[model samples]
Target chain A: MKKTALLIIAVLGILLLRAAEDLPFWGDPQSPASVHLSDYYLEESYEETSVPNIVTSVLADYRGYDTMFETVVIFCAGITVLIVLRRTHRRRAKVISPRPERPGADIILQTAARLLVPMMQLFALYVVAHGHHSPGGGFQGGVILGSSLILLALSYDIQMALHRFKEKLVLLFSAGGVLLYAAIGLACLFLGRNFLAYGAWAALLGISEPEAHSHGMLGVEIGVAITVLCIMFSLYIDLASGGDLDEGL
Target chain B: MEDLLAYIISRYNYWAAIILLLIGLYGMIAKNNLLKKVIGMTIFQAAIILFYVSIGDKRGATIPILAHGHDGAHQAVEAAAYANPLPHVLMLTAIVVGVSTLGVALAILQKIYRVHGTIEEDEILETIDQ
Candidate 1:
């Protein structure tokens, strides 16, 4: 069986090599991917949406629907983990007690995390808010924010993290984020524009069209950040504890 | 022969991506353990992400973020002067999707382990075959 698998991989490798011959060279300026519609997205995105970051403009404005569904997909995965793994009983004793019950492992990690969590969370918010001007957006910020909580779980204890962020609240935030994104689209629609057409709301907000789009993109990104942050922590706690939500590493 | 070497060097990014993919494929197929198969899936997704990001690269270009002006205002952006942003945007979702799938797959594996008492594929199949 292993030999059969090896043979298959070899054949696939050769096929891919053949296909690679037709692909453009490394960093070819005229490569199809660069010269095509991406040029328009890069050139016009800022003027259209007032967001200087091309990636964020393209992601949250041009391809807004795709990103909204992507957020939903991640949310679905988190819910599946919750449904599949969540248990009524604790599976094992806590890995590290919050009060440094174990000597060698706890002291350093706890101290570092104590210093880092606030800084990490502050940076995550900065990343989310600064996406319009720089290289970060809701997804990156959400992951970083989630990691701060995960660090809390790892350093102190799952119980301590859970104490601050209850499981029910996390799940609610995940659902609420997705709902907020949908609400923005619906609100745009009710304002007599196409779904997810941010310019429509400009009249209501008394802002210019481009400024409205920028604000809309920011709102959607905040929704995405909220969903991603909670879901990341939810997945970690559930997976780490074998669905029991207690005594996680 | 020289042209062939240049061609190979130029398009070598795909070669690395394909190699990573094959490694994941072998892990998935040859490894009987469910946990290893899930790990293979993660690697396979990662390789695809690498491939897409490589496609977005441009020679003599800056990062996708636009640079601010000397006078503290937006400059007339040169498209070719920046790496393609589309692929990076798409792959961001791809990466999040990859993490989501891994989380769900591991959760399913946990359930399978709970039911079958072992995570080895052949053993689970043998038990079912009885």
Candidate 2:
């Protein structure tokens, strides 16, 4: 079976190589990808959104519907893990470990994490906030934020992290993140505008139309960061400890 | 052979993606372990992402962040000045989705292990047959 698989792979590789012959050369300026809506996005993003980062403007403003659904997808994934793993009627065994067992074992890692976690969270916030003019956005920033919490779990243990972030609180924050995003949209609608029409806030925020778009993008990015941070940490706690929220590796 | 080499040189990214796809495909087809297959699936997914990103590349272009001058001078914006941002945006979301999927997959695998006591495909099949 392994030999047959090897043969199949070779054949497939050759076939793909032939197909590659048809693709445009790397970095071709006139390639269909760059010729399509990308040029428009590149040209008009700043004028429309007052944000320097074309990618963030496109992701958060132009294609917002896609982002909204993706947020829902992550939320659903977190909830799925909760449903599948959490032991509600566990007459089995609890995986609890209250004491530190040995405080000095991971002294180096603990100290390093203590030093690094704050900086990581700060950088994550920067990435989220400065996404307008840089190569980052809420998704990248949220992952970094989530990793800091995961690092906190790894350095000390799950219980230490859980002390600050209760499951109930995490759930609320996770749900609330999505709610904040929807609320912004609904607010726009209430003001006699379309859902997520951030220009509606131009008058309220006392900013120009383009500036309002920037502010709106910032708001949505914050909402995305909150959801991603909560969901990622919640998912990690569940997956690492099999939903027990106790002693985890 | 020289023509093929030239073509390969010009489109190396696609060729590399194909090689990665092959490696991932082999792992999925030949491996008996479920976890290995999951890793293979990840590799396959990564190859696809690589292809999309490579397709979006533009020679001599800066990052997707538009250049700004604070002096209030209206410089003409050129499309070729920056790399295509669409793929970057799409792939960013894709990466997040990929991570979410991987987490769910690992969680499901844990459940499968707890229930089946093993994570080998043939072993699970045998148990089911018995």
Candidate 3:
């Protein structure tokens, strides 16, 4: 069976290589991907959205619907993991080994986490806020924020992290993030424009249309960050504790 | 022979992506362990993401960000001067989706292990049969 699988994979690889030969060469400025809509996005995104980062403008403005659905997808995954692994009642037979009790939290690790977590969280916020001008963005920033909590969990314990961020709050934040994104679109709809049309927001907020697009993108990016941060930490706790939420690795 | 070598050199990123993809496929297909399969799936995703991001690269271009802050809109921005941002944006979502999928898969794996007391695919199948 393994040999057959290997043979199939080899044939697939060869076929894929052949297909790849027809693709544009690496770093070709005139490649199909570099042309088409890319030129439009590069040249007009700054003017249209007032966001200098073309990727950010294109992601959260031009493709706002796609991003909103992407947030929903993440929310669904978080809820799915919660449903699949979370056990309210304790099982009589524990298939996994019991988490061993430590004597106490290590002073060195706790102190380090205490010093580092605040810095990490501050940097995460900076990344999210400066995403329009820099390489940083919501997803990257959210992951960093989530890892800070994970670091806390690692240094102290699951209970410690849970005490800081409750399980109910995590679920709320996850759902709320998606809600925030959709609510912005609904607000645009209510203001006599199409859904997710930030130009309508300019009238309401008393700003230029492009600035409104910039602010709208910022709002949605914050939503994405909130969902990602909560879901990431939630996944860690659930998996580490094996649904019990008692202790974690 | 020289032309073929030049072609290969210019498109090495695609070749690297293909090799990584094949390794991931092999692991997914041949591994008996569920956890290994999950890791293989991750590797597969990484390869695809790499392929996509590589497509956005331009030889003599800077990043997608405008050089002159907000004033860049006033200037005549050359499209070829900047790398493609579309693929980068698409892959950002893909990376997040990949992480979420891995989390869900591992959660399911935990449930399977709890019920079956083993994570080996063949063993689980045997127990199911019995």
Candidate 4:
């Protein structure tokens, strides 16, 4: 009954938000947002970017400012993960022998890891590259990619996975992604355009505006996806592998 | 009737996405297991991706491939133009944002698990109170 009531409220809330479009209190269709967003982008997008994907053009170029901030937010998250999960040398010394492997852990996980890891990574890369033409993007691709490694850890041993990727390497991968994104922005600044204005650098690269935007967006998205994927695996490692497992064995 | 049904079917993506999102939310808020909560969060985030992807799709539109045509002059007779590729592009960033947030959340959960020796919310709280 409570769940039903909550669902009713949620439905009503959605309806109410939708109804706000019909209200006269809002500005006219000819209002600034409508003029700029719906009309201006509709007409000018093709000319500016030559890309059929208006959302991509807007996100990668027109509103590159917002995307830069989004990248920074992810950078902040990476830092936070390090802060939370970093182990002290002293603590490492104390955690001397590893604990025993949990009963049935080996039998359950070994076969699956041997079979699933490569296939999952392939799917993740596909999602990342085809993002412009399809529904999958850096984030989805990153998670799928990250989860592939996480699955290996879960099915095999957390300690084994940690040794493979290591905390330091994951941290570096996360930092590298943020740096690449910022470096692109700085590159635009050096070219006399605003941050991420790859179109301005077209003269150097000899590419058209649309192609430049596509390349730039791909670069940044790659950075974002890589950072996301590495950080995700790092989190799994932090959660599952901490403390000495062999001591219990 | 057929047209109406077709319209609804085409729009079913949003409904399914919303349902998945709700289920995820329920799992996140109600489940005691930390792993279950993380799984719930993944499902919820996946729903958002589905919603964003569906928004990019237009009825009767083909994939946004640059065909052998210029400004519809030499366009194929059967070509229905292209669906907006922007939403798919935007979703790429959103997917990254979702994973980053999920990573942070999982790290926190891991820390909590470390401190409590158990991942269940009740068990963690009991350990904390003591």
User: Docking category for candidate 1?
Assistant: medium
Instruction: Report RMSD for candidate 1.
Output: 3.4
Worst 10 residues of 1 chain B by lDDT: B66-75
DockQ of 1: 0.63
RMSD list, candidates in order: 3.4, 2.9, 1.7, 6.4
- Chain A: TM-score in each candidate? 0.93, 0.91, 0.95, 0.74
DockQ score of the complex predicted as candidate 4: 0.25
- Chain A of candidate 4: what's the TM-score? 0.74
Which stretches in model 1 have alpha-carbon errors above 4 Å?
A: A90-105, B1-5, B69-75
Per-residue accuracy of model 4 over A126-189 as CA lDDT, tens digit each = 9877765555556668788889888877776666677778767887887887788778878988
Fnat scores for every prediction: 0.84, 0.82, 0.89, 0.26
Cα error, residue A179 of model 4, in Å, equals: 1.6
Worst 10-residue lDDT window, candidate 2 chain A: A91-100
Best by TM-score: 3
Residue-level lDDT of model 4, residues B1-130, one tens digit each, is 9987865665566666767777787777677798898998899889878866665555555654443334523322222245544555566667667766876887787677666677887888888888
Which digits, one per residue and each the tens of the lDDT, describe model 2 over residues B49-88? 9999998899899888888976534465799989998998
What is candidate 1's CA lDDT for residue A157? 75
As a whole number from 0 to 100, the lDDT of residue A135 in candidate 3 is 88
How do all models score by TM-score?
0.93, 0.93, 0.96, 0.67
Candidate 3: pairs in clash: none
lDDT, candidate 2, equals 0.87
Off by over 4 Å in 2: A1-4, A94-104, B1-6, B71-73
Q: Give Cα distance to truth, residue A151, candidate 3, Å.
A: 0.8
